[model samples]
Target chain A: MKKWELKPAKDLGLPATERFRSLRRESGLVSTGMQLAWWSMVRGYMAVWHRLQITGKHHIPVQSPFIMVANHASHLDALVLASPLTWRLCDRIFLVAAGDVFFETPMVSAFAAGMLNALPLWRKKCGPRAMGQLRQRLLEEPCSYILFPEGSRSRDGQSTGFKPGLGMLVAETSVPVVPCYLDGSFEAMKPNQRLPRPRKIRLNIGEPVSFETVANQREGWVQIAETMERRVLELAPRRGA
Target chain B: MSPAARDRLFGFSHAFDNPVTLVVTLVVGSLLLLAPMLVWWLAWTGRIDRKMKSELITRYWSWLVITPLILGPILLGAAWTIVGIAILSLLCYREYARATGLFREKAVSAVVVLAIVLRSFAELDHWYRLFVALVPFTVGIIAIVAILRDKPEGYIQRVSLGVLGYVLFGSCLGHLGYLANDQNYRPILILIFLSVELNDIFAFIVGKLLGKRKLAPNTSPKKTVAGAVGALVLTTLLVMGLGSFVFRGTVLAGPGYLAFMGMLISILGQFGDLMLSSIKRDLGVKDMAATIPGHGGLLDRFDSIILVAPGVFHFINYFVGVGADQSVHIFTGG
Candidate 1:
């Protein structure tokens, strides 16, 4: 006889307020339904408003346990990056959002967790422990993440140097990190803008790269970050073209 | 629909027509009013510490909110009572699904949810035949819907979990709603809810005072044999005293029959509590969810009522049929 596997929800014991902010939070039927509806609406809005276009969509791994790292310029960066993926993967995909911006208030936290299906990354207080938890979830739940390697959105349109935190999640693991670039998002919705403009947006996805040989140390993390940064930057259009 | 059926479904004027309903309402109201004074007295005597005092007050506040939500619907009419039960069924199933990891099977969950809605419709329409048929019908649908995933692995587990969820929450709890079909449903439901909740309190108090031996410690460590026996005696007596009025002039009103019904409520209520405990032990979860302040999930608060609902429902149904004089198929007339 085969023993049955019983896995309780990871965030089962937490209070309701804390559950929304917990990294271990898992969505049930209601939250999943909400996310599906929210994402579907967002997809429609993006198509009509931004005239969103995608290139190299085939580069997205058919299965999960992968990471999608893109340049962050606008609040719509995560939405644009996630819009092209199949709806079947909606529940398993978690956007690693900024905790302070997305999760500080109760209403916003609910929106982020319930609608966007985002997991918080506290940039100010984040340490290796938080990064380690994210890494473990990616490989164990075999789920995918949509993260911004630049850590935070750029003040100006120019891209910033990729932070080493991105390497902490995928260093020396078989998990593939697919580099992506978002063009015209800064023009559409800058960090200071309250509402997004009706500018067209383009998403360029590059082939996935793995860091299995790289050591799980600071130097290796920095190296992986630089390589990913270069790959994403290369996908962007020429500066003067 | 007949005028009598309309009166039972939506008429609030007759909410207190039954003396038993009036007494139960007064008793619950008095308890809520006196609880704060009792807590203050305990605090003054230094019998309970500050933390315990605050916890007790928090629990009392939660009950204050919960009592009105429960009694308001029953007072309004049977229609609202059925709707309330339907919502409770969905929330309880949600907690169960999340705890058992069955929520991951979206297909099976959708089938279970659809079955619950259908069962609610049956109850609302007062369609007894369809209400009874839904149990097996839903189990079959769950089995079929689970296969659509095309993955045979864990097929039995998923199907079994879905069936059990539907049976426990959708069907068993639905019986409580179905009882509203009775013309005297307000008093009957109040009696059942009051006794079931009191049964838990009796066990706790008696166990604290005189309990020595463990009663299935592995299943529920805090439960004692003395507590169970004490509750069985007290609750049976409570029911015998109160149930005579609720079941007046019916076959169930006899002393012997009422005593038997009381014992059934107490025993089955204990079993229901233990059943949820066993599930928690299996899943290694303490409480289902932190829904109610100081009381854990709705399942945790109302676990005793689940089994007691069906057990007491059928017992009365057998002796003197439930809703015998009330109009049937009120919404879906033949």
Candidate 2:
């Protein structure tokens, strides 16, 4: 019916839903009133993004929890991604951030740890040692998570390749990852750009990619990354497209 | 045995008419009145940082919407209190266990419920000793025995830790129940509660009426020396006058003593409040629990109670712990 509805159906182009299943991923956010307050603020911030309007939000099940993954093109990616999910999920939620950057500042650290549900990704601390506990946190909490598979910011305003790290996370948790693309945020604020333009931005979220569907296919990682890039390419500015 | 059993179970509410109990309650209460003012003074004088705000909305929702409309009257009244208290204890225990991660693998809910039930016995004098024994001993044994089957690692150590926490945080606090209807005990409870109440009341009125200086700009922005004074004044009045009602005029005291003790309790009550606030700041929890819509958890309500109980207990003992007739019904709460 609406862009929001179509976007969820297939627009973001994901390898499999499990690649970004929010529930199957680790929940590092603490649910607190302060967090809930900040979450609402983040939602408002997303609405002002290109005047985005949500529809058929209920297509997302009220009871069933899912995983959320999106193409990270700008700093605003987490807010835009977490916003729609907040409107849909209505419970404790979180996003994965680099432990080195987000967890370093006291204020940001408090916000991340307090209730925004931030999980830290460290390149140095790779493998099961990290995956095992993240897996446990997911099982223990009925929370949804938002992850950017690229792990770092993408320059030149395009979705980067999906790293094996993301696929590894998919294998361990086996949760659905809903691939989403930002139509205007890359240009709204890109690499080396300290500020955003007043132009309208659109975020297209796709149905989840199931890990079960992609687990055996090792080649699926590049295919998944390329698929995410292709979907965002569809939503890119007409000139960028 | 039927009447005898019921009689043993439920003692009629009682009080004392003595010099010792009366003086103790008065002096302890008097100091409570002065506490908030001193705190306000510090905040106004730029000593304690005005870092925190009242966050009144959250508290109002808890007290007005949840407690009064849903759980409060039940707790302070008939039939519902036992269950209310159990629920309260459970939530408090949940917050603690979840925060500390001490009893990570154990079912804190079931354990809290069991502890609450056993602790309830302490309220009934007939089973007081049993209540104390149930926690550190009986529950301890049962938990150890139960865990034996699982053969959990550090079996004895885990059970001991769990039982100790349950006893300290859960059951030992049950002594609040013994406070219900006892006159001798009521003096201390009343004085302490009144003084703490006075802190909020006088601080509000005085701060509004005459406050000119902010005590602690960084720690607590709104507090003032004037507000602290207001709290002290109100508590002194209660210590000298409201107490007269409790004593039926027999609890004699000079106005000077009343003023002096009132000042003391006012100070202590404020100390208690600040202590509670500090704990919340450390843990980063707005309230102890979300159960009470406006009031907060039992910990929140009992924040000052922890300090007031022992403070006024000794105060009542010193003031009203005298005279033949007064001692007759002392523990009986006659």
True contacts kept of each: 0.88, 0.00
Number of the top-ranking candidate, with DockQ as the measure: 1
For residues B121-166, what per-residue lDDT tens digits would candidate 1 score against the true structure? 8988899999999999999999999888798889999999999999
Angstrom error at residue B313, model 1: 1.2
lDDT of 1: 0.93
Judge candidate 2 at residue B137 and give its lDDT.
65
List candidate 1 segments past 4 Å from native.
A239-241
Model 1, C-alpha of A67: deviation from truth (Å): 0.9
Clashes by residue pair, model 1 = none
lDDT tens per residue, model 2, B186-285: 3534455556666667876889999989755443457787887778788778777755655444443556556666766777666665665664564455
Candidate that would win on lDDT:
1
What global local distance difference test value does model 2 have? 0.53
